[model samples]
Target: MDTNKVDNKGYLDMELLRFSTAGSVDDGKSTLIGRLLYDSKAIFQDQIEAIEKASAQKGDEHINLALLTDGLRAEREQGITIDVAYRYFSTPKRKFIIADTPGHIQYTRNMVTGASTSNLSIILVDSRNGIIEQTHRHTFIASLLQIPHVVVCINKMDLVDWSQEVFEKIKAEYSAFVSKLNIKDITFIPISALNGDNVVDRSENMPWYKGSTLLYHLETVHIGSDHNHIDCRFPVQYVIRPQSVEFHDYRGYAGRIAGGIFKKDDKIMALPSGFTSSIKSIDTFEGEIEQAFAPMSVTITLEDDIDISRGDMIVRENNVPKIGQDIELMICWLNETPLKLNGKYALMHTSRECRCIIKDVKYKININTLHRNEEDKNIGLNDIGRISVRTTTPLFYDTYRRNRNTGSLIIIDEQTNETVGAGMII
Candidate 1:
């Protein structure tokens, strides 16, 4: 059985794609999202009726499309997205999980959170506004997160009369800015989320435009190679021992493969203790499997009896990750309180856990302009910075750009237990 065929609702088969939307206030970010859902036939009848009624109540001639994604009561009232609201929709080609993020400067952390797990990022720019500060900031964040693909959506084309010059100007300005960043693939599209142009279907108005529709591009983009398939890194999350008489002798180390692929009979080594073993079998809740890949949780029985527990890593002999207590990281401060110069915090990386203390604050990065401020001592809310940390135990990891699942981590305050920061290993 192909487990990937089962949907969350168990009614359909769809391949899931996680994506994030980013733009400044009034850039039509929410409106674009609402348009996608509405035009794609993903919105419910009740939801549509409610929005229509609200539009009439507000004395608007047309229904407010932005209302569809502005879910919070405060957000709806303020006409802005304050937090990340995840929306689910599906097309025949694929299913989508959208992380609708806020665009306010104070909400940079929210955008980072939303984009962290996304395979692609849709950056909206107002055609009349061209490439502005917020556009630069969002694009920088997408680059910093190492998002695999970026689709620059020049929105509100109708506002600019669908002028080809307007689109070309914004495209040229954005292209220059993105050239400095480490973005992999970039595409530009002219769209009017309000008018349903170039969103789900081809636009008849823009005859000069010859690009795929936004939905078409998303469904066909190659993302199969986004995951690391060479370096095997599995951090054991739990030990599964079926006490039932039928499986009394079964002892399995369970975890989601963070990188690479694993198969039965492969030679593996458990880290920290340096014990060697071979995978006797791979098991899932459904049944045993011949092989498993990154992001899939499975249990492995070893041919040799080895002591492996939670927080330990199972890796291939030749492709082991860095083993060290000292690590350098590019961290984004997510809290309002300034990062303490020598503060101690709990670090959670994959299934491995440990406590780490900040050794130094290297530099703070200005996201909008890509400027590095080395003299800054404070890392307050929504600030991106580089810092060195010393952990109680060695962390087995790779650079975040190589394997997002294995290379990323979160830091929590010991007293409040609040996630204070998110970091990508350097």
Candidate 2:
């Protein structure tokens, strides 16, 4: 294979999509991923031979595709996934990143970590079991994380004789339940992962289904609108100063664009300081860029020499983020220890770090039932609830639904320095 030829043929320009899979035990989540990789020709021959040998050693009659994803020894012995396994593959049209998360209820925190940054989510449902508690749990998490796209792959269609009735029944049930959810985009497909039906290629057995296959949908889905381009948010991460004799006075603010488009000569405002400046130029390693947008990393030079440093945000004067010390948010406790009320923890936002105290626990949410427990203030591991926080410094943020990068934060235990909770500004 010619590496240079592949690189020059628009390989670096291809758009990347991150997706995650979730389901209950024996629901075929791992098998579906293996089939996707196999049918897409993403796996090598030696990997296939190794899985075949492992399957034979276990005395299985057929090769187990689930072994491709369940890489840990404990997972193989218990026949269940325990951690979040990430796999990468690419087709001619686009590149893909798959996060295979554990399905057990106790590992709910693992699923949250995997799906937090995903553009889409796949919730595998066993056709024999239909909609269950775990299905609701995963769906609710997908919604909480604001994953834009959802594909409910109803697996094991072969076991039900490829019946169209079973497919529609599950679809209808899911639709009725999800009507109350905040999910905007959802697609349902019936597939037998073990048989390679409707995963990558079109299924011959399911003639009644007229929709595109899973891979086709993933490649064609419109994700350009998933980002927040209306709000201008750029949190300064580093201040670059040159000590060279040729360009000794050059100073640039370096950070990833959190939102909106920033163009050369555009007027911008610095947060906390309230100083205004015009963009002198945008600097990138390749060359001076004319403009930059959300999620792009670039260094910007301002016309003024006003004092600026890390943790300060640059934004549009008219459309500024909310600046305050008190914030209300939905908190997901991640550690094994219970969250302490009125406890102080190290809080980190985009390019900013400070200390925050849990001022109040408003309510705890039951993910399975989508109910809020107003009376219970105690929050434990894998538990999600609404809480009010008071930070040491004013935080500039937008609602998580509007801007994920600016609205999300992590709380660390001050003594252990371990991350104990994650929050989304409500």
Candidate 3:
């Protein structure tokens, strides 16, 4: 291997973990994120100076860490996060993307938006408050979204006198509640986000706790098996045909791998068309590769000239996705406008886009209580509900559990062109 090879291959190979921070009001979610950024030295001098000045203006004794993430003027003025704030940083071992979502009950849609792409979730709980309704709601959403890992940080441990008993009590309560949920791989840590205890470094104050620090756990968590790599699925987003004088015969289908793997000369079939073709070559900007896997973006060329376009799927013949016009999914209504019964909207799944009508509203999920409200068919803003829909054309999809990328879709308002809802096929 060349010692100083160019390109982002090394960075690409490094583990990239996207995690979301969620909690109720005053749970220190923003402060925790600020602490992580500050401890990791991911903050710039200007940013630190700006926050320091802001902190002084607010008459704080110490530099306010929460000022780092609460970037909006309104958020700072109100002292509350109102939207999904994204931050990026990297450790020596792994790169990280943090989605700092709003904790208010009305902003549940924002939490869903932030957690949708997260591999893990850091749910902050004030040690003084233990587990509350918001805690249950956040945990339920994490499980519903199928986050691979979860870390329940018992924050404000300093205020609690760093008591092991308090930590254990909260841990037991959280564990018992999650037992009723579909969540797996949960970890507990006692930390004072304000004091930087057991965040980036292990806390000397809590010597009773022997687990790894938050950063260490985040850096080393195994996420290799999180992606669906068994069933090959690719949705062609674009058809590239460079009509130039030099080598004008090139025809390639461009898309990101939604699932499984693909290689040169692999037998593949195009969905809706029922046409079969063999992969001639897999091309990328960096040169040809022997194989490509899930989440990778590459252009594929078929040996035979077949009619394939955007919304068309190229998948392994043996592992075909479900093809149908009717789909039942759990949708998180995103817009302020209530989801109209029998209303038609533009549904985009993978690269496929089609008009879909709401056929029936089965039930709405009460995120706080984790109960199904079968009697209520009205899904308003931030409501999670099970619904049935019919598409103008058949969709090729897998259940959300099987493939996150291929099994999810967005509902778009045709008139306003706004994304109104996000659905996970069940």
lDDT of 3: 0.90
Rank list by TM-score: 2, 3, 1
Residues 1-426, candidate 3: write the lDDT tens digits. Answer: 121234645655667899998865577776788778867778889998999999999998978777787888998998777788889887666889999888777999999999999999998888998999999889988988889899999999999899999999999999889999877699999998878889987899999999988999999989988899899999999999999988499899999999998999999999889899999999999988889998899999999999999999999888899999999999999999999999999999999899999999999999999899999999999999999999999999999988899889999999999999999999
Provide the lowest-lDDT 10-residue window in model 3.
1-10
Query: Which candidate's lDDT is highest?
Result: 2
lDDT of 1 by residue, 195-239 (tens): 789998788889999998898999899988888888998999999
lDDT (0 to 1) per candidate: 0.88, 0.90, 0.90
TM-score of each: 0.94, 0.96, 0.94
> Which candidate tops TM-score?
2
Query: How high a TM-score does candidate 3 get?
Result: 0.94
What is the C-alpha local distance difference test score of candidate 1? 0.88
Task: Give candidate 3's error at residue 258 in angstroms.
Answer: 0.7
Off by over 4 Å in 2: 1-10
Cα misplacement distance, residue 180 of candidate 2 (Å): 1.4
Score residue 198 of candidate 2 by CA lDDT: 88
lDDT by residue for model 2 (107-175), tens: 888889998999999998899989999999999999999999999998899999999999999999999
